[model samples]
Target: MLESLKVLDELRLNFSQSGLFILNLTLAFIMFGVALEIKFEHFKKVILNPVSTLVGVFSQFFLLPLITFLIAILLRHYITPTIALGMILVASCPGGNISNFMSSLARGNVALSVSLTAIATLSAIFMTPLNFSLWGGLFTEIYSRTDASGLVRPLEIDVGQMFQTVFILLGIPLVLGMWFNHRFPDLTKKIVVPIKRLSIVFFMGMVVMAFMNNFDYFKAHIKYIFLLVFIHNAVALTTGYSIASLFRRNATDRKTISIETGIQNSGLGLVLLFNPKIFPPDLAIGGMAFITAWWGIWHILSGLGIAGLWGRKRKRVVTIQ
Candidate 1:
């Protein structure tokens, strides 16, 4: 099994940058398809149910990062700063598309999940960099003690570049996807499913490329990477559920929040990492890539279990009542 995996990793390494770019383009196209499924009215409903949406946004954008920052501080005492920063970077990301899919499977408020994911993704154009800079700055205070070579990159946090990227990659593609669905419903349906499957394959290819290029770096940072990702994901799940409970949200809202907070836009993370001036740890790049990839898969499985239990418990309560 190990040998087979090694062979696969090497093959991925042999894959060129052109292949990686193709994978990214596939991801963009898949996201465009998802956008087609989104109804503008779905986002509008948030205005009606202000509490749930507000709570979700708060947990996603604010509370999760706050909790992550605290945890990162504690972890810094014992671990390298690269790993700590990596956790922060992942936590700061918005809810991913998978969160919407998982929320639907969990019998949660799928509309609410979609709304939060949309809002969070849009907000991340600014929030991601700001939160990263804030946490990165804080880490700088403690980073001196921890020996992480090339931890500080020239991260200017260009709002213009970020906005442009979001418009092209997310906003514009999403609108186009929705338009296509509206105009050619049958074609949209046909393409959506295939594009979704392709997106997964494309994502896996990117991960393989990362492993191939930086296998040694990942090997060295494997422990820190795993530990950081585990803790970061745990904090995200806790923040989502805890905040929902604090606000006395319903079962459905709680489930939505949990998935939203836990799943992150790792694609955005990779785009940010690629900027040499911005997070310059080549090893950290591999670490974030591997950890996020594995974490994305694990979180979905864990979410399924949690959502199942929540649904079952809710049903039982209603039965007893």
Candidate 2:
């Protein structure tokens, strides 16, 4: 499998410059929609009730990436370098915007979910790059010594460029949307739902475009990608829940943290991967692209599935009472 997957290092996805622009815009728009739901009150909630929020943040930005690196190391012989790095990148991303919806559906703490999302996004401008660089660099360094195949390239990422890209993509829109929401409360309320719904639609369209453009590559390698993502995502969800439980959090908080940690901002990962400045076009990081792209679709399915099960379980408990 590792030998077969080596071909992914040389495979390039069919994304053009214009498509990259659209993807960036779509991600920005989604972030803006996410900001509409955030307010000063959410931050205040964090200040007053910091335990769960901090746990969620720690679980996501700290533990997830570390766990992913360990998983990559354990499965080193079973996976390629790009695939391992792809998992690291996704783990390094912030929680997904859709997690709030899934949390609500699962009868979890929606306020905590939103708070975690806002905090994670803000922190991601720094944490994403830091975690990815730290873990990715370490992974390559460790494996390069043992594997003489010359496949492991040094993780040569421009931290300054990444910081700039993350700020422009996430920071600016987040500030603007939050400001707009603060200034016009009534309008924000009226438009937030539609914008959130539309953002999800646009993001799904972006995923569809990615699949359409690289259908053949995805078709050939999706089996391996699927299994890797499945295990990785399950670990993420478990990490969140286990951390929350270890901290003695309530059931709702456990659910919220689990969902938040499980559903990563793979859309952001896609944008970063496609950015020529961050990752040049000539670099054959197709495995990274495939993992990031498939992750965007799979997490949604997994999140919703888990949320549905939790919802049904809650309803059954309520009936018994």
Candidate 3:
């Protein structure tokens, strides 16, 4: 199994160009399946449940990034700016494309999952760059203030360019996915499941390959990366549930929001990391890639634990109430 994983990882790195294409295709196709299953009436119902929606949005769009920044700041004695920025980037990222699949598997509100993914993807075109700018900018200011001349410059980023890229890579695929559901329902249905399964495998391979390619560097960072990833993911899952419970949303909505907030599109992070203008080679993006990829596995276990615990608790309450 380990050997196979290594081979897959190598293929993933070699075929990343094609791997990315496959990933995009899979996201569009699965989301298209989700779109087809959505009902106008059900969608309206989700919208009407404004509390759940707002809490979810607040946690994802605002709270999580804030928490990540604070953690980075508190740990500034040990963590580097690159690691800090990496965590912020992942935090600022929107819901993972795989959330819909996991939501479906968990038997959560799949419709709401789809809608959140779609809206978040669209919103990310603006929010991602903006959030990063805010968090990264603040971090830069702080470091400069404290460290005197040794401080690194704030990320001089181009929000417009990023927005355009998101439009092409994320927004366009999303629009096309939704369109495919409408235009080619049968074909969409026939292939969506198979493609989703394949995408997961392909993506996993990409993660492994990324590690293999930079195993030495990744090994060095694994200690800190593990620490940050755990805290980052824990905050996400807890904040998601807290917001959900605060608003008294249904159990199903809680599950949806938790999964959506917890899973991030690490592939997007990888893309940004590789952009030379963003940073030099052997920069922090590799750490982000490795961390986020590992986080994905841990979160599956975490989400399942949350689900099972909820299921048992609800069963007992029902037996009494």
Candidate 4:
């Protein structure tokens, strides 16, 4: 297992130029679909109740990365620096494209979910690059402390370039989608369901294409990476729920924050990993690549499971009451 994971440092997932382009377009459309669920009322509620929104954002952008840092430190000897950085990069990302839907499915605060998603997505433009650089840089420090060679590459994120990329991918599309939603509510209603379904399909197809491009590695190593991702994801969900609970937010709010924090935008991470300006294949950030790909698939399963249980539990509680 150790050898398999160590090999990831050298094995790069080859993402073709056309594949990268399709991935970017697919992710942007997903972000646009997420925006369709947003409205002024969502932000208005967040502004009024601010506590839940603040807690969710804090858990996502701040606490999630911090906890991931500590987890990396704890597992320093067990995992490669590249894999640890992959975990950090995912933690630094905003809530996933499906978080709002999960929130609603769980009988949580849909408004807070949308509000947090909007704010977190916008914030990720800056926070994602900053947090990844900041925390990922720390991994080098930890490794350098023990290794005389100090060959582990610290992830260097260019904030200026990232800002431009994020704005074009997430910010602009979001603003346009929100504007369209505002301008034509009926039209938004007509297409929102189909768009959301298609976005999900697009992403699933992206994952399949990436695997087809690197079938041998993905098939061989997926099992090795599963538990690491599960633990990391668990930390995120727990951190959000714990913080929200500490603040005495109700069950619905707790569920919203938990799901939001746990389900990160790994699609964005994959995008960066594939970008020539970023990690790219030759850099052999394979640990990052594998983790990102698996996380994308695993979190969907975990989120839907949790949402299903919560949805059922809520129904039971309502019946009892």
lDDT of each: 0.67, 0.90, 0.66, 0.86
Range of the 10 consecutive residues with the lowest summed lDDT in candidate 4? 149-158
Q: Highest TM-score: which candidate?
A: 2
Best by lDDT: 2
Per-residue lDDT tens digits for candidate 1, residues 32-94, read 756766767777887887899889999988888778778867655564454455566777777
- Give residue 151's lDDT in candidate 3 (0 to 100): 45
Model 4, range 89-126, lDDT digits (tens) per residue? 89988999988889889999888899999899889888
Model 3 lDDT per residue over 48-139, tens place = 86566667777898988898889878866565565667788888888775677667666577777876776677788888878888997898
Q: Using lDDT as the measure, name the better of candidate 2 and candidate 3.
A: 2
Overlapping backbone residue pairs in candidate 3 total: 1
User: How far off is residue 85 in model 1, in Å?
Assistant: 1.9
Clashing residue pairs found in predicted model 1: none
At residue 50, candidate 3 shows an lDDT of: 59
lDDT of 2 by residue, 188-304 (tens): 999998998998899898888766866877788788889999999999999999999999999999999999999999999988888888887777788888888889889999999
Every model's TM-score: 0.81, 0.97, 0.81, 0.96
**Per-residue lDDT for 236 in model 3?**
90
Candidate 3 global Cα RMSD: 5.7
Instruction: Report the number of backbone clashes for model 2.
Output: 0
